[model samples]
Target: MKKGNTLFFKTRPRVRSYAAICGSKEKEGVIGNYADITLSDDMYGESTYEKAECKMLSGAISLAVEKGGLTDCDIDAMLSGDLLNQIISASFAARDFEFPFLGLYSACSTMSESMLLSAALVDSGFACNCVAATGSHFASAERQYRYPLELGCTRPPQSQWTVTGAGACVISDAVGKIAITSATLGRVRDWGVTDVNNMGAAMAPAAADTIMRHFKDTGTKPEDYDMIITGDLGALGSRILKDLMWEKSYDISSNHVDCGEIIYKVIEDEFQGGSGAGCSAVVMNSYVFTKMNAGLYKKVLFAATGALLSTVSSGQGESIPCISHAVELESLAAGAQ
Candidate 1:
């Protein structure tokens, strides 16, 4: 049911299983130990970085379905996206699966968008089992958004490294570790940030907008959630979001954690931190899921933010438009239904 700016699912769809797959550098990061698979080579022995990204996404989707003790035939639908133009990675990967596929595009917020659709489908009984995933490749994104790999261009201080990874989750009717209860769809917000190099600042306002709306719509305090996780905000954007929350008289400092800030180690030389479609996807499916299963987090707000500016739009001197989608996840023991 729609509640103000949020969608509340009475029959919360359970997250039966998930899988996280990444490259070598990501494997060396904080959530590495929790990932289902990590490739020694970022290329994954593929001919190109784009192909490699498709492979990681395919692997994640297959692993997630397998983890749930199901196969492609059992999956009713597959929804996924990537940072690439037309979401080529997701579309190309979907070719391997016989199930119905829906290619989505919400930049880095793709994970939340895909998950929201999956939860709605499962909760509505439109699908018995659904898989939603997203991914990004460093080489691929760099070439498309910034410069080519051959340029060896210097990155600005505010720039974040695009994580070479993928993550997938299986949403089913069966009660499981965690269930998605609500989703807050964000509105596009342009804060007049024109610097394409600093995605953090460009996307911060949207994250804050969604976060505040979610709290208001649900009549919940920031303290109500065990954790409030944001996607690809890095350090600067996270701070901006906190400031915005404070302006609204809510202190989210205690439980807020940014996926970008924690995905890589501090000394990894990743400037701000990780940013990409894969950052939140991999971290949530791995670290967050593992924590929920361990009973460490009873309630979590997963808000994935995205900068909706394309290369053409940026080149045309258009301010970056950003959005965020938040999903409320709670332990099944809470009796969400």
Candidate 2:
């Protein structure tokens, strides 16, 4: 059933399995504890950072499928994305497998966007199994969006580090511990913040807008969810989201957490924390999934925020149009109880 911007999945596609792999730096952080694989080197033995990103993405997908006791051939579709010019990481990763591929790009919000569509496809009987995945490489993103690492440009306090990681989840028609119950499609909102360095500020408004719409459409409230997780709003953006929601009479402060703010063990050096397509992906697949399976979290409202800005658009003096897509995941055990 469709309600406003939200789509309810009666079939309840289950997350059959998931996996995450992070770079050397992330390996020293919180995500490293829960990630399935952590590399000793960010390069992963690849000559180019771009190639390393592809390898990470491919490894994540393969591991997820293997964990489910399945193979690439078992999956009907592969939906993936990355923070590259043409989503080359995802597209090239898909080449390693034989499944039908659809490469998506929603900036940092690509994880939830891909998973939302994966649920829809499985719920509609269009596919029995699908892999939703996304990844981002710090080195690759720096070269593409900002100054190359060779230049050693100083980062601003408002700037967030692009995460070097990848995550993948297999959504299947079969029953499982956690199931995707609904999804809220977000609308674009630009507040005329032209500074590309401050992505959290640019995307927070859209996060609030989507969260508000999700509550309204589903006849729910902030307290209904065990956790309200935002993908990559960092510390500054997370505060902005709370303020925006408060103005609308929805207080999410108690239950809310931003993946970007907590992905790193220490936030001082990284400034605003981590921001990338992989930030939320790795967090969801590793930490959040572990908590859910352990019965610590029964219901989760995952809203992955994205800054829809390109180097061309920014250079043209255009504002950053942001978006956030929300996916509702519920533990089947909670329902059974």
Candidate 3:
């Protein structure tokens, strides 16, 4: 079951269906067309930005369940997380669903955490259907982690834009074209990076650690997976991870891609790019999964990175500890292509 820091799922529960929903800014990103629903208004009709994030998260869950041909009653459990105090976005979203909910908080890496937990539940015969979801909002996250939106504080070149979106996937016991085969749970790594604004630097070490462990545990190499996509860690972090892996004699530079780097358009002036639970969640379920469904990709290793830093920790001048969780997604029909 557990090898090194990775978990090899024997059941291989299928990701039956999924949905990615986002706002106008994300709609302008590279994979915008892949999103299931793109709203013109970032608010989604909510009075507050927090409430809007809640809407996006819950809406993604409902959308995923519906697309999977299941209703709320069929979902045995819901696993979710977000970037907010007490993770209110996920908890508030859970209020709209009937299933049991578990609020997870792993910073931006929560999407992979939720999915890994959901697959484990189904694999253990504890649940037949599980919904894994998470999200974040630029407005809500900015005020909580950095500054208030009204202040209009200037963002640094190294800073990442918290994606205003949510993504959800319905994992079921029923066999499907796509399945989660394994997961590499990350260990917290701290490189003494204290800048809260530059999350990519703070999280890249964890990403490298998990990737190396995954290859060792599974007896696979960089070429085993078609693509190795990291969650956030934006542009600079991706480069750092590559350098670190290269130092370890594992060259992943060729097939490696960072979710943050590709999430937005280069012309958007978003600096490095997007970072949030929603970044990888939406990108995988929408863009990456869509490509897999089309038989364009066979196997992918999705590593969602997160900086485990609290506002209290940052305020206290503590270094940021980071983590990443990698899930292996394989397409059943890839050989047919």
TM-score leader? 2
lDDT of 3 at 41: 93
Q: State the local distance difference test value for candidate 2.
A: 0.94
Candidate with more favorable, higher TM-score: 1 or 2 = 2
Write the residue-wise lDDT of candidate 1 on 242-274 in tens digits.
Answer: 999899898999999999999987734788899
What tens digits encode model 3's per-residue C-alpha lDDT throughout 1-337? 9888788888899989999998788888877899999989988998999999999999999999999999889999999999999999999999998999988999999999999999999989999999999998988888888887778678788988888889999988875678899998889999999999889999999999998999999999998788999999899888999999999999898899888889887725778889988898889889988888777888899899999988999999999999998888888865524
Q: Which stretches of candidate 1 lie over 4 Å from their true place?
A: 333-337
lDDT of 2 at 171: 95
Pairs clashing in candidate 2?
A: none
Q: What is the lDDT of residue 312 in candidate 2?
A: 98
- Which of the two, 1 or 3, has more lDDT? 1
> Global lDDT of each model?
0.93, 0.94, 0.90
- Local lDDT at 173 for model 3: 87
* Candidate 2: Cα lDDT at 284: 96
Residue 45, candidate 3: Cα error in Å is 0.8
Can you give the lDDT of residue 204 in candidate 1?
92
Evaluated at residue 134, the lDDT of candidate 1 is 98
| lDDT of model 3 at position 196 | 90
